[model samples]
Target: MGPVAALSALGDRTFGSLRRHRNYRLFFAGSGISFIGTWMQQIAAYWLILELTNSPVAVGALALVQTLPVTLFALVGGSIADRVDLRKMVIACETTMGIQAALLCFLALSGVIAPWQLYVLGLAQGVAVALNAPARHTLVFQIVGRDDLTNAIALSASLGTTARILGPAAGGIVVAAFGPGVAFGLNAVSYAIVIAAILAIRLAPRPQRTAPLPGILGSVGQTFRYAVSTRRVAVTFFTLILVSTFSFNFDVLLPLVARLTLDSGAQTFGLIASVFGAGALTGSLVLATVGRTRMLLVLVGALGFGALQLLLARQDSLPAVCGLLYLIGIFYIIWGSSSLATLQLAAPEHLRGRAASLYFFGFMGGAPLGGLIAGSLTAHGGTRLAFTVAGAMAILIAGVGSIVLLLGRSARARRPRTARESAGV
Candidate 1:
């Protein structure tokens, strides 16, 4: 079935606090614009790096500049989220990202952009996300209320996927028709939409909690313990790490595939990425209709994504990759949204912000390491080898992880009844 048809069927059953919320609609709309712009800049930035450096290591380094900061600081961001007004924190971070995007655009337009400059700017953007992502997630429950947490997250995921589809396509067109600077400039302006969304909300005051620790390491350790103690939260984070390792490489790999394999240009690379977003959009629609509490959806998505990656790796044809990426995108959205929903449902109300922050910490923060390793492998071994290795590893990891989860469930099921336990060990 088509996306709209599938979504319509899925939307028949609604649950949670989000079903009737007006403010959530506004927030969802604005977040969509912002997400689209962010994706646009991302596609443009990767293409720009490829154009400037012509080296895989340089491209990987640039990607590293964008993700390394998050790995280092997202837990701290989570702590900030719990202590401060998350809405205000998100606005501040979005503002910083806007400025960073503007600066990159100006530098590129003025013919003064260099490899080092890109890395520097990328680092600044990474810092923005380190602060923004956790706060943004934490604020969603505030806007929609705890009852609608699952729906709110699903809607946001759909919007994000929609943006993913639009941004790369638009960025590709802009880069081909104008240049990277124009794409960056548009991304800068896009942040205004998100800022306005944050301003428009009138949320109940969030609970104020004491800051957890003095330094970054201490805070992270605390957050880590909390996540592992929560079954769904821990499972979701590891799932994201694996999925990202296998699938997140698409954007990183696209430039190479375009220039070398497809004999294409910036526009072609952007189109391929956009196709992935399109798939994600489809996945998101499926999620939106599927209702809440579907934990098994994530496992299904993981296996599906592994299969898609395997298909992409075996084929040398760009068209084949495009089709496979769409499927990959769909599964990715399912995996991501399902996991986030589960985590939000499973977390203690008081610790939701911290839990969400730790989630982003592992997911987005781990991207750099995964990208770096994938890029290095690809550089030495070529695209097929890189995809082959990554795809195989992802499939194996997912299979093992799923089996373990199942076995654990079975073990728990076999435990003696509570009444029997009271009687004897």
Candidate 2:
């Protein structure tokens, strides 16, 4: 095939899910715009924190404030998703988030913004995230059904990756030219677009609860039991805990890496994030096309994710750091998308909402502590020490996982053959 033909073919494969599913297409297109604004706000928020406090610990504290709500409330949110009106829940939560964004913008514009207020607003936004995650994630399964679910999910991730690529770069420029408050205002408006899209969606109705509904706590308990019993999910969740706690502190670490280590500002910070997002976007597209859910490949990608970061710790220049970040982002998405699909696939449809929430439970659970660790390391030692510890921990967790899986395969391989196989036809 010619080069242009190859590009077209790749595009077709990458977006196959959108072509097949109308509802997902709407979700993807609308969410795509909002995601860009989300990324922009993320970049601006991190920059603002740094400017106000000039303390690395405060940056990590910001992560803690946002994620602690997820840890505390996500399980309950998942239970509500399984039983309630998902579309309505999502709309309500998103509106709350938009209001929080508007408040932040007002504070910033008025010259009264402080770290404490930022933390308080972030806590409110985090509650919305806690409520929103399960409903929003599970809603996709209803839209596209099981067979096409992974592809749709991967495509959604690709959308987020694309937003990441655009958002930070734009945010960096905006912050430099305008200010962080303006970026926050843009985010507030972006939520309306997504809300309109959600209102446009029509889902196939599901059966009403025919029996007495289980208590919310009971339903959540059931999900916990199911996940622990499912070996693949258990392992994957463990890995997420490890990686999320350590390797995923980029928002906390990167600003310091840019301002202190690289002697740069918002543009460079945005560039660093955008470059990683580009590589992550590539990885998401590849996964959307292939849509693999095998456990082995997930571990391999995670190990590579960790290994690349080990190399990242040694780099001091922009080119070198960005290059390493790009590769790490590829492995990051590969591991992330594969494992997420695997966990969702493992659950029965009724329990899928809670299962999805459990995924984030592991995914975002340790992040608060991890942010603190990253911040402390950077404050005391430097970015080098922070990256070194994160990289090493990821390597350790993924490496152990790989070794256990291989040994299990080997043990099964050595077991006695079946009578039919021993007799040989």
Candidate 3:
């Protein structure tokens, strides 16, 4: 083929997942639209809290309330996903989210919204997310099948990153022009689009399970045990816990970095965030084209993420900070997408929901504690010190994980063969 044709073919293969699947296309379009609003709401909410309280700790506390439900109930969500119709579950969750967003809009527009009220609304939103996340993730597998799972996941991440790029900038404009109330109202409308798309797509019928389902507590325990039984899953979960807890408090970190460190405001914060999203979008596209996941990618991504954070901590200029955040975003997506793909691929079909939930628990469950630590550190020591601590923790976790992985590989290579191998059959 000619050069142009070769390039065109490559592009087709890179995006084949979206082109081949009708349901996924609808999902992609719907989710893309909705996520833009979601991120807008996120930026507005963070800024709103900061405007109201002018305290990083208060921001962290809000984050804690938002994520604590995931920590406590995500396993149950997983259990429910395994037993229920995921389509119905997701629709219900989206509707609930819409209601919550409407309530926030009403509160904000009425001029009676308080910090405590934001917390209550945040908690409500968190519950919907906790219930929805597992089903939403597992639904990708059903839509695209295992062959395209990696690409679908990468595309989905790319869509979300794209939304991040657009949403924050739009949010900055909306907040500056109208108010956070308008942003909340936009988010409320976004959910309707997602619901409409969900209603339009027809899912394949699921096979009924003959075995009895476990109770919620039992289900939670079973997932925990299953995760620990596999070395790779265990290691992935452990690394994620460390990274998510220490490193992924960007909502709390970025605004403070803009205001306190860079001496900037909402627009600057949005710009920095959009730059990071741009980098993440680039990374996700790369993954989508690669069409596969690798644990090595996850490990290297974590290491690079830590190194960039270290560099970010030392930088003072806005340009320098933006540059570092861009690099951080790329590595962050690599780490996150690869880790999730790895865990999902390792899980059996029946356990996939539970496994995904475990992954979410590790990734988001620690946010409460992480937010508290970050807020406290930022309050007491400053943003630089907080970044320093987060970077160091990530590096330490990655370093230890690398050693463990290497030793495990070495031990396996040196071990004696099984009886079947020795029998030469």
Candidate 4:
């Protein structure tokens, strides 16, 4: 096939889910555009923090604020998702986030944006995110249902990865030429688009919550019990906890890579970050086409992702590192999409929101500790050392997850055999 033919085929494959599901199509289309704007703000926010403080630790603190709320409130949010209309919750959260972005824009444009002010906005953003993410994830299930769960997640994951490509690449230029204010303003407007999309989504009537609502803490405890009891769910969450804490602080690593490692500027950071996204988008599309949530893929992808990050840490040249990042991005998305799909499929319908919120809890909870580790190590030994440690932790967790998977497989194998033996006797 020629280049144009290949491009057309790619588009068809990547968007197959959208073609099949109307509600999901609307949700994905609007969310996709908004995701780009969110990333634009994300990259610019990191850069802005670095500019104000010139400290890696300060940037890490920014990550802390961005994540800590999710870590703290994701369960409550998840609990809320179980009790409410996901569409309305998502709409409210998006509105709140948009207002927060507008405030940031004003702060930047007025030339009075302090590091504390940025941090405060981040805390607000985090709360909305904590509340927003689980409902948003569960809403996809409401749109597409369980049979398409993995495929839907792959496509959904693509929104963020693809945004990584356009958002940061454009953000770099906008921030470099104009300022972070303009990017923030664009992000604010982007949220309005998502809100409109949410309004347009026509979901099947959700199951009535006939049981009295559990206390938020009680609901969270129930989700935890469910997660740990199901073998696949258990393994998936453990792997997320382990790898996410160490290997997933790209926000911390990327800025340091540009400033400290490459001795470069915003454009370089933006470009390389987009390169990473290109690799990630490639992986997301590949997984979506395959349409399987095999545990084998998740385990193997995690192992490879870590090893590649280790390789990435060793590179000094921008060209070489960019190449490594591209490969790492591929592994990263494959692992993430597979894990998320598995969790969604494994959870019972009523508990889906809590399950997803717990997933984010594990996913982002490590940011505080991970950010500190990245900062302290980068401050002393540089990005190389921080990444090396991050990579090693990922590998260690992958190994543990693999053991759990194999043992589960072996146990499953023995069960039917034992039953057959009794029948034979």
Best by lDDT: 3
lDDT of each: 0.77, 0.86, 0.89, 0.88
Candidate 2 vs candidate 3: which has greater TM-score? 3
**Maximum-TM-score candidate:** 3
| Candidate 1 local lDDT, residue 313 | 76
- Total clashing residue pairs per candidate? 4, 0, 0, 0
Q: How many backbone clashes does candidate 1 have?
A: 4
Model 4 C-alpha lDDT per residue in residues 93-159, reported as the tens digit of each score: 9999999999999999999999999999999999999999999998888888887877889988878
lDDT tens string, model 3, 1-425?
99999998889877888999999999999999999999989888999999999999998998999999999888889889988998999999999999988999999999999999999999999999998999998888888988999999899999999998999999888888889999999999999999999888888887677788788889888889877865577778888878999988998898899889998888888889898999899889889999898878888888888888888888889999988988888888898998888888887777778878987898899999999999999999889889998888888888888888888778767998668445421
Q: Best to worst by TM-score, what's the order?
A: 3, 4, 2, 1
lDDT per residue for candidate 1 within 129-235, as digits (tens), equals: 98888888888877776666766676787788778778888988998888889999999999998799779987776665555444556656777887776445566
Worst 10 residues of 2 by lDDT: 416-425
Tens digits of per-residue lDDT, candidate 2, 89-165, equal 99999899899989989999999999999999999988899989888989998888887877887888878888888
Regions more than 4 Å wrong, model 4? 1-14, 415-425
Query: For model 1, which pairs clash?
Result: 10-289, 17-147, 17-148, 279-330
List ranges where model 3 is wrong by over 4 Å: 417-425
